[model samples]
Target chain A: MNARKRLQFGVAVAALMLAGAAGAAPVKVGMITTLSGGGAGLGIDTRDGFMLALKQAGDAASEVELLVEDDQQKPDIAVQIADKMIQSDQVDLLTGIVWSNLAMAVVPAATAQGKFYLSTNAAPSALAGAGCDPKYFAVSYQNDNMHEAAGAYAKKAGIGKVFIMAPNYPAGQDSLTGFKRFYDGEITNEVYTQVGQTDYAAEIAQIRNSGADAVFFFLPGGMGIAFMKQYAESGVDIPLIGPAFSFSQDILPAAGDAALGVMNGANWSKDLDNPANATFVEGFETEYGRLPSLYAAQGYDTANLLLSAMSKADITDADAFRAALAEADFDSVRGKFSFGPNQHPIQDFYIREVVKEGDVLTNKIVEPVLTDHADAYAADCKM
Target chain B: MLLVAEQALNGLQYGMMLFLMAAGLTLVFGVMGLINLAHGSLYMVGAFACAWIAAATGWFWLGLLASLIAAAAAGALIEILVIRRLYSRDHLDQVLATFALILVFSEGTRWLFGSFPLYLSLPPALTGAVTLPGGLQYPLFRLVIILVGGAVAVGLWLMITRTRLGIRIRAGEADREMIAALGVDISRLYTIVFALGAALAGLAGALVGSIQSVQVGMGEPVLILAFVTVVIGGIGSIKGALIGALLVGMTDTLGKALLPGVLARFMDASSANTIGASLASMLIYILMAVVLILRPQGLFGARA
Candidate 1:
């Protein structure tokens, strides 16, 4: 009511408003990933790895506001969550889907709406080829990279005849094709089992009779675990090879000794000698009390990439942010990570061997299979 | 000739596993008239219990025993707490309640043991392959499963045909009200039968878990196959379950083994393999439909 008191209040309000206008608002990110069911292990690692990077950034990442949701590995659920995040939450960017099918469902729509979609995993060929968009970035390798590496490895090892198998799905088809692309050997058999098939007795019988010098399979998650266990017991001495999805750290424990001595192709391993990787492996083991898988590495890189872009350009400017992301200036845990023309990763691939490391079964880098390898679909992308 | 024989054995092994699951499901349906969707959850429970105990104790035998006890105990507890209330309810209500129980068990198990799958290694004695007649090298573990499944089938047969509990179960299946009026503790008998069925499913889970990854949803795929077996075999007949399981298993295995090669003769090898594999997955359902068309009440329904 008094003139002096009113003036003081006015001054305080003015100061507060000035301060608020001076500081930038935090960038909002929506992460939808599998956090339940059988695939939860993959999602949990991704979320944890992403969170660890943000935690390490400390004050720098304070401007990031993350909203996480569980997809339960369902495409419809992922789409619904994406819609909610873009419309209601008004997220500036979206990320963190583990499966390619879910990525196909959410990424195209999200990018069309002018939102940057950074994939932590699941880079299907469809999105990498004619479907490539300016705003969509795959922080992981293209789906075929590991399989291609396996094929190249098989060729190098002089395996004359190979038997290949995968689940009956689009990714499965891509997997076999990727392997065959680089492997110039006689394919003894190309078998497609049921998506979630556990019984492989008949398949094993076929493998035994085929007398292939080696076998390559792309059964991911629990399918891989079951196949490995069954194959080990079958007393079939044929060498086994596959992509890293099956032999990842999350699965190696469940697989036990069955996974030992198996060769798998991967874009990165925990033992990769790089300062960024060293810190990540140490921090992840300390925080989560478990070894980090390639999914985790991808998650860490995705977070760092986001952070690097944020430091360079304002997220509100779509063009500036897109250019910043394309720079990929972050020190990736995978050592050498860069984007291809289609915005998918152009990275080195390694052949890893499963070995016992201090009572824990994990992978060690055996040799580099592909150097600066780009995807087969990149040439098809108009972008 | 050798491959055919081996494929047949694989079919038999697969059928035996299906028999364990279908027997339990059919018995629960026949006696209690309850469509228990949570039967698979009990299977998952058995696997988790076995994997956990086996890993902790380093004894596969103890883990197998624990699987049976744990699954039976879980079944008994659920029957008393949730299932008993639904006995008088319609099939839809039983299905809904049991479906809810599946979520509960899955989430509860995930809470106890994290999302990662547990390992259950085969015993060393049963690790390698054994040469059979004509130099057929078969995995000893699978052979053991066949033998064990055979033993259980015989044991179940004797119990059902010759034992007093079996007679009561048969009488209960015929007329529940009459059995209750005859001074049978119908509630207790239902609990016992449910537990027995649960025990069998759990045993299957534990045995199969050694060969497969023992994870949260591991039971679901097998559960679907078991349901198909139950439908193909009349809903209430043990003998029907056995015969139907074998038929389904054989069809699925043989179809997968021979179809691709057969189709390659007509078409290109790649397309033939793809088409044949897809068709092979559908073979069991086709068999079921054919069976249903011929005999509306199923292969061995007492009503027909």
Candidate 2:
């Protein structure tokens, strides 16, 4: 109650208030990804990439806490993880979803909470179009973007009577849809099997019987391995084509010789020749002792993008930080990346073939499908 | 017709694989009355063990043997430590506890093996393709699987029907307390049964691992299908499990192969595709539903 004590207290309070007024609290970003099951190969790589970038970026602005949870590759679990992150973790930003269904389940919740969501992967078209949210941004391209590029490449390669197969799911439909969009040739047979199917011998038989000149499949994860292995063993001479998923580094080792000469398209490849990518590829291999998959590349870029946005923004201001992210002013391993109006990535897609470079097998660049191609749903996105 | 025959063979192979998993499940259930949701975890263990051993020794036979022994050991350890206490507990308690075990096993596997999938190579003897009567060139490995499955079916039947241990198992299933009173060492029997079931599951996982990517939680989808098979065949009945597995497998494989083409005749390609894919995906479930309707206790249910 003394005069001197009261004055000191007043000064201390004022200083604390000034500090609070000058900058925002420490930024917290939540990530939900699969840490188990078939998708774990991609999910864990993504986690390592993001964490590495975060560490390289130095101390968290105001002490950034990255809250991470495992979706476990289930939709219900994904939703629960999202809810827990939003409510318990109290993360102001959310990112990291590799599966399209999981992304679709998580995005609306983040956006409705006024949180910025940076999608590391999984770019369903609806989000880019009618379902777009101003606060949501994708560090990776839309789901269909890679497949669309594959279709265009197939057309250019003079492939005809292509038999298309995909898992019978929404994302599967999107992949085939994307492929068919640019492929104006005759599709001999379009088959959709149950999601997570192991044996594709029956479908392969059907394809062989149909006399299709080539095959385009969208089998991802373990399904890809099983199908490619079986297809190769069946001695079918038809050229097999698909997106990066069916023949990625994570899958190729399992597919073994079956993966040789398999053509696909992707946004990022181990062999991409950009300086940023070269650094990433080298650093990832040295750190992890394995070649980085596309998932890892996207994950690394996601964290880097966030850091770039943070450096650009007054870290204390949430609105400014969100705005900076929306602008997407960052160098990406994919060479170039910019956010379209729908907050999804507008990037290049490359046609790649599995080839042996010395002792190691990796994707070799065959052609570029599109340069700075925007997503098809951008115009539909009112935002 | 060739496609149909090939697809039917695919179904048979898939069903036999299911029988391998389901037989173990039904054995554990029929004798011990334990739900053991962690059965899938055991399958995963078998796969990992096979891949690890095969890579280390460069011997496929040794790897397969290791898978069986590892799986059995794992099953015995689990049964003694955790599952033994759970035998007297409620199904929900068992389900929740086993579910926890699933998380532990999954996390443990990931921690030990990291996230990359392990690949298993086929033995050279079973690596090539064989032409079937229908002019379809099927993988020789798949044919071996079908043949092994048939042999196992006969072997299991002989064991259960003709052997003294089989009689003891049957007696134990009928009256656990009486069998124990007769000095059958019930605990040992239970452990043996559990280990045997786990070994079967492991063998199944090892057989299929070469064809598929061996990874964490890979056992779960197959486990679900096995559950459907057992349910449709009559839970706790070995014969039921066999019949159910084959039926469910054929329905799933053949339905997927033929449904789209059948629909295409009457509808446009796109519409037929949408309908066919949906139906094909649901075919096994539909079969389960039909079985439930016709025989609530299952196809070969003993009078209860």
lDDT of 2 at B70: 97
Candidate 2, B1-304: lDDT as tens digits: 7777778889999899999899889888888888888999899999899999999999999999999999999999999989999888999999999999899998899899986677788777878688877678888888888987888888888988999888888887888999999989999999998998899899889988878768888889888988898889886788988999999889877876788899988885556777876797698898899989989988976533
Q: Model 1 - which docking category? A: medium
Per-model C-alpha RMSD: 3.0, 3.6
lDDT of 2 at A80: 91
Error of 2 at A81 (Å): 2.5
Off by over 4 Å in 1: A1-21, B260-278
Instruction: Pull out the clashing pairs in model 1.
Output: none
The DockQ value obtained for model 1 is 0.54
- The ten-residue window of minimal lDDT in model 1 chain B covers B265-274
**Each model's DockQ score:** 0.54, 0.53
